[model samples]
Target: MAKSASSVDWLNRVFGDSKYSDLTIECGESTWHVHRVVICAQSPFFDKACSNGFKETSSKLIKLEDDDPTIVREMLRYLYTGDYLEQTKEGEEGSRRSALSTNVHIHTIADKYDIPALGDVAISKFSARAAREWKTEAFAGAIEEMYTSANENKEPMHKAAVAIAAENAKTLLNDDCGQAFRKIAEAVPKFAAELSIEIVNMKEKMPPTFARYRCPNSMRCNKVNMLEGLGQASGSRTCTYCSNQYYVNVWVSKKLDD
Candidate 1:
């Protein structure tokens, strides 16, 4: 069911005003005055923590000293609103990379707190940011974080990363801009293997006309190798503009010419 605007506003006010708040969630020096019904209903960990026999049941407080305060705040926000805005730290406040990192952290922490829906939301946000910023250094950092984080629900995030990397292989594997990407390929064997498989799968579905190759003489060479154009079956072709020879593959319907 869709939530009414008034209800969302009321909930936001509850979170903001702390009206009749029954539970206090403390992370580092920060605290969220929340309610048991609102928070516990969505998080199994919090539900268990606030159940009878737990000290928090009587104390009405849960301390999360180990979690990042910014992440915790976003988590609380999601519990109330069913969504969260990116909350990057000072230096990174507006950058897409920072937003990507925030989503990655939220995914892992959502898993930690047994909030599967929140984990899914985090991955969705992570993927959107990743698609836009895959060429940036932030992508490599996010990949490392995704692999290193102790989260069990990683397959969706893994597929998203590998897909982005596979689709942009020329820039991600051959260009100097991809140095960090190459380093990540070396550091994470699992990611490297998954990316290789995705690349192979992508190639199997691609048509011959989609193949592209750079002319040896110039960086500005037209990369398109559409069969309908001057492109032909594999052999040496001299660049008309640069007079340099380069190899092109037909990839289908023709044999390699000597």
Candidate 2:
């Protein structure tokens, strides 16, 4: 463990050192001096771009016109340290939401570069950040961007964003963030359909309660006894209005006699 730690420290130092950097990555108007070996080790796209006979092989410069420089920096950090930097402050909700947005951007950059592992790391961080701030308008907007930018070949981030949106549909569809939800539905029909299906599935899987159940046909069933005698298990019921079947799981505890 100590050796591993020392190795990580050495790699971090090397990553920051400019003395041995052999390649330069230009993003937008900004430039980053980086090691070709380090980047190629993590990304096949870079490996090919930096290989012999390629234009970048002689010039030792690669231009990423579409990627943000800050995201590229984070990608380099992850390549060297095996971990990406987390900029969100603890106990600060706004900063945390911003961090989630940044993670999604980083994921996009990783996907663009064909670095699947880096994309996976970014998605993991994004998921953690979303768990903390999924109801925020910032997060909803980030999901919109993610779904919009995602292509057919790369869609894990889109799927993850849809899952987050579906899980928080009630809060996200409220007055404050309703427009963002509408935009997502309009821009990405497949994602919208998946979210709707997930919402219905979630409602069907909700635990049984005495409160009246709302049917898909816009009618309410006030059958309180439908769940009264059911024990701690899953069961199905048919809505009287739509005649559609729904499933519910109930957990009831029984007193133990000593």
Candidate 3:
């Protein structure tokens, strides 16, 4: 169920307000005043950090020096509001990270913090943004980040990039926009292998236009012929080489382009 407007307004009000805040999250030069009940409940990492025996338990502050400040801000926004805005402030777009890159980084941060829901949201947004910006430098950068930062086997972002490349193989692999993608593929062997596998799977699923059959009489009349439109039917065929009547079973399992 969706939060009521009043509840959303209350959460938004609490997000930045220092009133009743029990924790201070510091990332880069920025700091967020947040409630422990909200932040710690949503994030297992925060919960552990704020529990007994940790310095944060007494200091009431968690410093994320290694994380990007912008991505951290977005993650906090999602924790407070249940969603995040993708667009940066006007004019800041030129200096800030691309929306696609932001989503990829957000997914990584969410995964690190053990917030599966936030990770899911970030990956879904990454997929949609990738579909729209697959031809741009931003997409290439996101692909590089995803391939390098995402360590899981066949990660969702990896699958998303491969799917987009498979759908637009011609333009992405042959056109000018493909140069960066090609470079990334060259640098990253696992990405290239996954892309190759996805392309092969797509090809295998295509409807074949032709079939090849060799005569069953291998001893004397082993004849081969390319047949089309047979549509999985059996028929009597005459062997032109040996003049023998034989039943031919046809299965159109070969693609013409192959």
Candidate 4:
């Protein structure tokens, strides 16, 4: 524990002070003064950037392009602390949405920089935040960005976003944030199809207590009266909507009584 505390203190000092920093990393108009050793120890991209043959080695300056400065700052923080700090707002909902958006951006940056551990950390945070903030517009944007930028199968964020979207299909497809669903459909047709199928399957597979039984003609059926008459027996019920027959099998769990 003493060694761990000492290491934390060392990292804090290194991140907090620019006194011994030998390198300057510029992103857009923003400049960050940092230690080359600290960055190189954590990232192979920096390892090569600070090597003898690189221009950064001679000038001790590296300029990054096409990267958000906010995300870059968090990336540096993760490099030093092994965790990225989330900035929260006044409202709980707003803060959570902001954190989710930031984590998605950080994950993208981490992947771009080949920092797998940092990417994993960012995605873990993103997944947790997403579970709470999935209904927000920020989550929609994050999902759009994740599908458009990140590797679809390799990134956990993509799958988590899809799962949340699937579970909340009614809200996501019909609400004000329906544009996100449309964007996903346009950007990734295969994923959109899969989500649609999952949503249909979910509605169909729901228990009688929670689900509205639908007839072949898309009309709601009185499942309770139908089930009461055919207790413990498998039979076909005629749909009142279309007069089509469908089979119904009831399976009650013994644990339901407990």
Provide the lDDT at 234 for model 2.
63
By TM-score rank, best first, the candidates go 3, 1, 2, 4
Local distance difference test values of all predictions, in order: 0.78, 0.70, 0.79, 0.70
lDDT of 1 at 108: 84
Residue-by-residue lDDT tens digits, candidate 2, 180-213: 6666677778778878888888878887545333
Residues 125-241 of candidate 4 have per-residue lDDT tens digits of 887877787777677777766666754334476666777788878777778767666666667776777687778888777654422344433345433222232334476665544
Better of 1 and 2 by TM-score: 1
- C-alpha lDDT of residue 54 in model 4: 93
For model 2, the stretches where C-alpha displacement exceeds 4 angstroms are 1-3, 86-97, 150-153, 174-183, 186-188, 203-258
**lDDT score, residue 165, model 2?**
78
Candidate 1: segments with Cα more than 4 A from true spot:
89-97, 208-254
Checking candidate 1 for backbone clashes, the offending pairs are none
Model 2 TM: 0.71
lDDT of 3 by residue, 80-134 (tens): 8888877688665323778888888888888888887888888789888888888
RMSD in Å for all candidates = 7.8, 9.7, 5.6, 8.5
Q: Which candidate leads in TM-score? A: 3
